[model samples]
Target: MNIQKLAFVILLFISFTICSFPSTSYACKCVEPKSPTKELRESTAVFSGKVIDQLEKGRTQFVLFEVKETWKGLNESQAIVETVNSSSSCGYEFEDGKEYIVYTNETDGHLEVSLCSRTHLLSAASEDLDKLGKGEEPSEQVTLDLSDEDEPPVWMMLSLLVVGFGLAVFYGIKRVKKKVNK
Candidate 1:
């Protein structure tokens, strides 16, 4: 009847609204990479490091690296690099407590890296190691000092806010429809 038709129309509208949200994931497009030596020459900082921590803010993931050795551009034993979250966006994913040979280029005063760069996990970077030879040792050992936290992460807070808002809207619509029927 009319009630069934109205329900179908509401469902279709809700489906369309959900489908219109912007997608964060994307396909990565990159040109053929240059030689290792060329990549090194073009990079502003080349080093091996362990990822101590990572924080995501907006579209960028901030990685805290404890530098072990330096081939170029880094003077501090600790550095922060910015990368995207998805490889499809050319972002390089660095796992916590894992060592990697990172090649970074300076972009607007921050170190940036992508999968298209010469960066790789230490165990898989033998070819790049052979090309780099022995790099300079870090002047001082760096350590992470993370404090214990009891609060939930930012994403969790945002998700809760969204769910609360959606429930409020759903109930409001249902109340309005009930009032109209009565």
Candidate 2:
């Protein structure tokens, strides 16, 4: 109920809220543009595959998968790739039994690539020139809405402020009442 105690409580609340917010950037679920080019360069490397499993390392999501067995271009090349899911903004939903092309590169560290929703690359669809209709639309890049990623939400800070002020007011009133009673 003392002023000193109230001030200390407010300070502690502020420090806790700052620590709770996210600091690390999240990886998007979508594939990067240079994935295809990376696939072309290496003769024998882990290019792509379906995500068989996933594990979380701190804030980063680690996607694990086997090599593409029925890949069309590479003549049956296969290798497992691990891509760090950095930001939840770009997080992907992995489907088992689906085929994908993986690309690996060394950036900051040894990093792997994941490109999804590429049914054409995977030999699942039939190849027919005349039978197939020519009205299919081209696929667009998948991008996450990262507008709120950097800043903490406004209401979050406001609520913290309200709670801190309320505590301070309650303590101030209690102190005044104790002095008057004495």
Candidate 3:
């Protein structure tokens, strides 16, 4: 009887473990960005640009950039790059009017960027800048003020709250059941 009870408890534990934690289907996994030389060699394009605007289309966000300088692959004065909207999906959040040193891959003739890329804010890309040396400047400079950005969307906050509540309920029931069993 004791052995049977032990086995039943072990099965219950396993069931709870499996049911309480679900795999995150939307998470992104990426390898670390390589050194500047390796990054330049591997990437299709590398440039500095100021984000002019962002357009959301389905699961992706498109950032329109006014190209300032190019190190490889492109010579256009304007470019559009696509990234997923969710940060968990390795998406890059480009602030409007902010300058960035973007590293990109050419996929189906589209420029793609992610958090895993060596792309970063102009203020934070000193290493890439040092390696790139001098580059041809754009003919015109553009800037915009976007200080009135909105806070986190309501759906995101509500989703987090729901998850938290679910976890709390799960643990609370487990604790009450343990006390009852004792």
Please report the candidate that would top TM-score against the real structure. Answer: 1
In order, the Cα lDDT scores of the candidates are: 0.84, 0.46, 0.82
TM-score of each: 0.65, 0.39, 0.62
Weakest 10 consecutive residues, lDDT, candidate 1? 140-149
Clashes of 2: 12
Error of 3 at 30 (Å): 2.7
lDDT of 1 by residue, 33-140 (tens): 777789899999999999998987667888999898889998678888989988879999999999999999999999999989988899998998898898987776
- Per-residue C-alpha lDDT of model 3 across residues 74-116, encoded as one tens digit per residue: 7778888889898898999999999999999988988999889
Kindly indicate the candidate among 2 and 3 with the higher lDDT: 3
Lowest lDDT 10-residue stretch of candidate 2: 138-147
The per-residue C-alpha lDDT of model 1 at residue 113 equals: 93
Q: Write the per-residue lDDT of candidate 2 for residues 131-179, one digit (tens) a residue.
A: 2223222122222221223556668998898898788777787876798
Greater TM-score among 2 and 3 belongs to 3
- Model 1 TM-score is 0.65
Error of 3 at 109 (Å): 1.2
Q: Which stretches of candidate 2 lie over 4 Å from their true place?
A: 1-6, 9-39, 42-48, 68-80, 84-92, 114-182
Q: Give lDDT: candidate 2, residue 13.
A: 80
Winner on TM-score (1 vs 3): 1
How well does model 1 score by local distance difference test?
A: 0.84
